[model samples]
Target: MQQAAPSASLPERARGVIPGGVNSGQRNVPGLTDLVITRAQGASFWDSDGRRYTDYHAAFGPPLLGHNDPDVVRAVAEAGGSLDLCGVGVTEGEVELAETLVELVPSMERVLLTSTGSEATFHALRVARAATGRRLVVKFQGCYHGWHDSVSLNVISAPDRVGHKDPISTGILPEVLDATLVLPFNDRDAVRAAFAEHGADIAAVILEPVPHNVGCLLPDQEFLVTLREECTRHGSVLVFDEVITGVRHGLGGWQEVAGIVPDLTTMGKAIANGYPIGAIGGRADLMDMFSSRPGAPVFFAGTYNGHPAVVAAALATLRKLHAEPVHEHVFRLGERVRTELPPVLASLGVPAVVTGYGSVFVTYFMDRLPHTYDDLLDNDTRMFVGYRRRMIDQGVFELPLNLKRSHFSYAHTDADVDRLIEVTEAAVRAQLADEGPLTDMDGTSTMGGATRC
Candidate 1:
């Protein structure tokens, strides 16, 4: 590893003002001081000390078109009319953005915008409760719905403590915890059991159809079908939190891919090409509940609900995604990684599972592909973290968390993917030096391994 430069002092100085020297807990790398990033463009960013890295973090999925996409930048610039707090109704850009969203998204009978995925999820829950007149909500274990009291339980915890009804953060009210019922992902029997027992009281059954929080675990067809059938039978609203999967998986995300429409959907991340925006869209009747025209309203409002310039950026982003081969490029690279990375681990004798869909993927040190979050608990977390540190040293940038998923955007090239493969093989060799290879398969393929690096 390189010696720490004086530039490291910036984060130390930030600690005096910001708690933990960062705005979000996820940014705090476990075994190393977080780098202070100075600038970013296209598929790479440089740290404060001028260290360059090909970024796979993608700001946790906001950079769908990559950093500073000129289309989004130009749109924002053209709409340079910044003071969007125009408390007097709506802007043309916001309306255009909303229309684009309604057209592209499967469940968008109506649209409501917010500035963050957390707020969108929170509002979606409120609509479910109000529409169904129920109090309890069912969320999957380890499927993060943001840091709100309603859905913050079990997103992160020690392995032994992960599959329970514990709150992920402190200061959440007990009532909030009680109102949320946490269940394991991809376990059909668990969902059936929960719905059977609390069917009458379950207002919403919300999950990330593809759970990306605790690594990338896909849904069993039976599991998703069962969610739809059971929720319909029990009169509970089904909500797909597609904040990370949206646009990256497809225009409509999980809904479009799976062909199952949730009553309400919360989208962000890739929606705005890295701009700050979130949207909740669904059936007209349910969304209309937000309007107090005749009856009571659901109390959903935000100051930056549809900031003009941000909306323009989102519009341009959606247009580019619609008119371009964005998905083709992302899925091609993603499929290459999925096909090739397993052999890399196999040759190194590292028992692991590489899981993902579309442009989001995660590497887990496990015996097989994880069926649920519980399945991921038995691996060597230290080895994974060590491998991540080694990859950083090799200039392949990823969030230094042990098991966070890697994200990719349209800006990454085949050459960048070559660097990713090279760095990954080196990291595996460094961290798994004494370990034996897990599988008998070939691992000498020079293949793509970019995405959530």
Candidate 2:
């Protein structure tokens, strides 16, 4: 195959070959469709046009230690030099990594490794079905488990599609959609109703615990407790999809903070600090369903399940996290952003709410904070995306999309947070100056187009 000519722009040439000129659909920013990153290091990435951006997107919350950290790079290099894939046997790095996970995460008596968060969730669901001998899986409306058929539906749904089975993609079997029950997050009555009607057939109740995908909807303690209690009473496995909240929130994951232990926990993202690694850990009895021997109840196999270099990266990241004041620093910076941003927004006459846990923040363009996916319908998507787009134009790299979380890494400094606030103020000023202040004339945002939900 012939490659495109050197004279062509990167995005243009990429479009000739790759779908949407990007590998992932999420990478294709809404208005800024051709944004191309060249290289990244500690808290910032350079664009193809030689523009530097202080990164808060953090590659969708995977680069917890920041991009291309020296420790992770060095560990990966050393492991690559000495170890290569030996598919039949586990490497020492893999065992040590698994041991660290089991030791750190709250719900792990046994662990299975995969290469992506989606794969981890996939295997977790399989294990749940095997353990319970049931077909129904319960998930929250805004909580995204993965791209798999079982749990892909009902995230970021349109207003018209809310409270319905709205699959994020096509080609999912109707039966798969029917088997998965989607309920509103933090709604105890809906949860009780689901279990009350179909408790006997419920295989699992899975959630993000925080639902960071919708820009960090904090879980109500009562809601989480209800989920735990219902899952226990119904003999259904409780699966916490902590792929975004795992090591990023703390070494023990969100379950540790929430004081609720799920039967199975799927993790990734911050685990390897940007490396391609994912894992599912749970009660030994349920996890033991997978075996390499014949007639295993659940078949779990991946060629690169425990790649030596990735394992080395994970170990090094975890070690650095423990050795350094990582959580303290990032959490402080996150708090600073959350605290400082509201004043800036208010000064600029932008009605917004800032909310997140440690090392994460999100700006929701609404008067009040949201507790459920239905409440998010009030979010002015126009102002949300407009403000972020303006920030990106000023070289602050927040993903210019609605309902996306902004992340902070260990490499970020107080200076970065200040810069973010400075850029945000300027962005909101420029937006308001260009377009008049918000009005309820048509019951929608007049900044851009109609409010999209």
Candidate 3:
């Protein structure tokens, strides 16, 4: 795990050309030198200097079967050679992909293909508003739906800013901000209150059934049940934003795990096994809003919506996931991660909480697992961020920050999990030994030994 800064000139080169030296705002962890990864394969990727990392980033949760999975790659290549984009009528691949989704998802009576999860989610909200004739959307705080105007408020805000309509991005209109009502996750009482106040005017209640965005905070059964009951009682569409969790749990996604059907579901990430694709599916009557027969039809069209190569990749990905015990394997790996890491932290006197479900997990800097966004405010995030950088230097690709989830794919072997625990222990010990006199993960002062990343 000898370290080298990634091609030292790359960051300067990128900043000269790209905004913030990156396309996505979150391309770099806070304290690390910016990197340019050169190649990726199963369960690992390499930086510009040929340093290989056991990748848990999973391309931010798309590569469930891991990078360059043979079947998905083959499907994409074959389709690219034959027909990649047919800008005419539908192809069998698209139709077959949709059919596969509908068959797998219990509530997918109808389906729409889109280029990204953001598009799928936007259209889902559109369909909900169109069908219900309501404009208000109820979303949980810290639950990120997408980059669209409607769903972009209150994502990972500071402690005092909870429930405030502070758009995380600039240029979001006041009206768009006004249309969204934010609440804390796992708060059934707040759900009740919001619905009681604005149920009649609410178009949809959207959230990740298990929120991966904020360190994998889970929905209490009561919380989820209340959402379902209230959405049903109020005629509001329940939209599950399963962009990260979709199909990572199973063939049918988190909805299958929860056993509660959302009125509409937006899916991406693991849906295509790293291919660029998205899908929105739900009840037939509501899904029909996109049809031409409607007088004011929801205009859901994208030239690349059903791109053949990506669709073929998605179909092949689904085929592999369905025909194999992918989830079982990954779930066990996830369990191994959650189970194994804490002892190392405890033995080294680092206070931390490890929480996750299925294949998505996070190592929080807090002493206990957090229940709300505000609770995360006091966490010694500086410590965890440094630990993650050390882990990267040890050739592991956990994102070097708090609040970002670590994704384990089916390609992660038993050896990978063992290596993960080993490196994490080494990283924590090294981090602790380098700096002196800082707070433990419990928010109490301790003799520290680590320098900042």
Candidate 4:
């Protein structure tokens, strides 16, 4: 191993070993990653430079109760004293967490825990394939399930590749790409056509019910119902990839809110409130493939699938959620942002649409809001990135990337939201003054020949 220079900056040192000086591609924000975070508590994080910023990124939506939440911290600490990985058998914490998930998530009758959302989705697809004895999977273009090769393609693809197979990374086999069918979100006819053409081959239809990865493209209820009906008719498993939407939206997830149930649901991000935990849950018959029986086909094995401290943290987070009005507070603040931010931008001649549900938001530089990824093609990518970058400069931490949604935590208050709005106005004003001519005839500066970065 090599060592960084004693005086070298954190990012400078990190780029030497870590790819792009970040672990995840989403964390590779141009300006935001330059500084290393020192610590975070409540609704803000402090950088190594000793500057505090009100956080809207929320560690990509994991810190729903906010960074280093006291309740979660105490629970983890307590668990650490008495409980560690035993590996041979299950712990009480894991069982309780699973029980809590089954009780809360409307669709989950049985549950399996994994260490990350990627693993949960991987297990989910595997379970679906094993259950249906099918190879092909159907995913919406903008909804990102995870990094596994099966569903890696077609998220935030370039304009030319909008409706085609465009893998985010190399090394994914062409056959793997071919096995997954990607379609436009909120397009009921497209979904129906795909089902009509190849429903029998599709093992599962997986999507983020709200499609938060490409900024919230709210699902049409009819489109969801269509998927449910089609998958039922075809014997294909219907999966809701709720990794981003899981406990953040509600205890029952978006499925409960939408009154639409899926055969399988993958959860993470906010489930444990910043702990390293992920879960896959669904129908008992389907999940039984991983049962510890003499002839169970699916292989379900993990050394640290449900680490005690992590499960304890999750249980504590849920307790706080049940005891406090977390959803009510965050939802009200989120609604305030959605209602207040747009008109403020419009007044500044910055034609933008703020889109999200509950505690997430994204300011799209477009006239009308989007219903599908195709509708987002015309969004001003340059301006979208620029505005977020500007917000970061002004001490409001919006991820400086196009199409990424901002997350509000339970720690955020009315004052924090007020600061966000004030900084947002300043950010837009600064961008318009610097860039010049930010609007087009249709009220959005089009991306126009530029690729999504």
Candidate 3: count of backbone clashes, pairs at least 3 residues apart or interchain? 8
Residue-wise lDDT of candidate 4 within 261-366, one digit each (tens)?
A: 9999998857889899889999999888885434789988788889998899899999899899999999999999999998899899877899899988888888
> How much does each candidate deviate from the true structure in C-alpha RMSD?
6.1, 2.9, 4.9, 3.1
Query: How do all models score by TM-score?
Result: 0.92, 0.95, 0.92, 0.95
Q: Write the per-residue lDDT of candidate 2 for residues 1-453, one digit (tens) a residue.
A: 888998988889989999889888788766666778789999999988999999999888988999999999999999989998989877888889889999998899988889999999998888889888999999988888878998988888778888889988889999999999999999999999999999999999899999988898999999999999999998999999999999999999999999999999999857889899999999988887897535777888999999998899899999999999999999999899888889888877778889999999998888898888888888776677767888888889888766889999999998888888988888777766765554322345444322322
Model 3 misplaced regions, further than 4 Å: 1-10, 31-33, 292-296, 436-453
Q: What is the C-alpha lDDT of each candidate?
A: 0.80, 0.87, 0.82, 0.86
Leading candidate by lDDT: 2
Rank ordering of all candidates by TM-score, starting from the highest: 2, 4, 3, 1
Superposition error at 86 for model 1 (Å): 1.3
Task: Go through the candidates in order and give the clash count of each.
Answer: 5, 0, 8, 0
Q: Is candidate 3 or candidate 4 better by TM-score?
A: 4
Better-scoring candidate (TM-score), 1 or 4: 4
Deviating ranges (above 4 Å) for candidate 1: 1-8, 81-83, 292-295, 434-453
Residue 219 CA displacement from its true place in model 2, Å: 0.4
Error of 3 at 309 (Å): 0.7
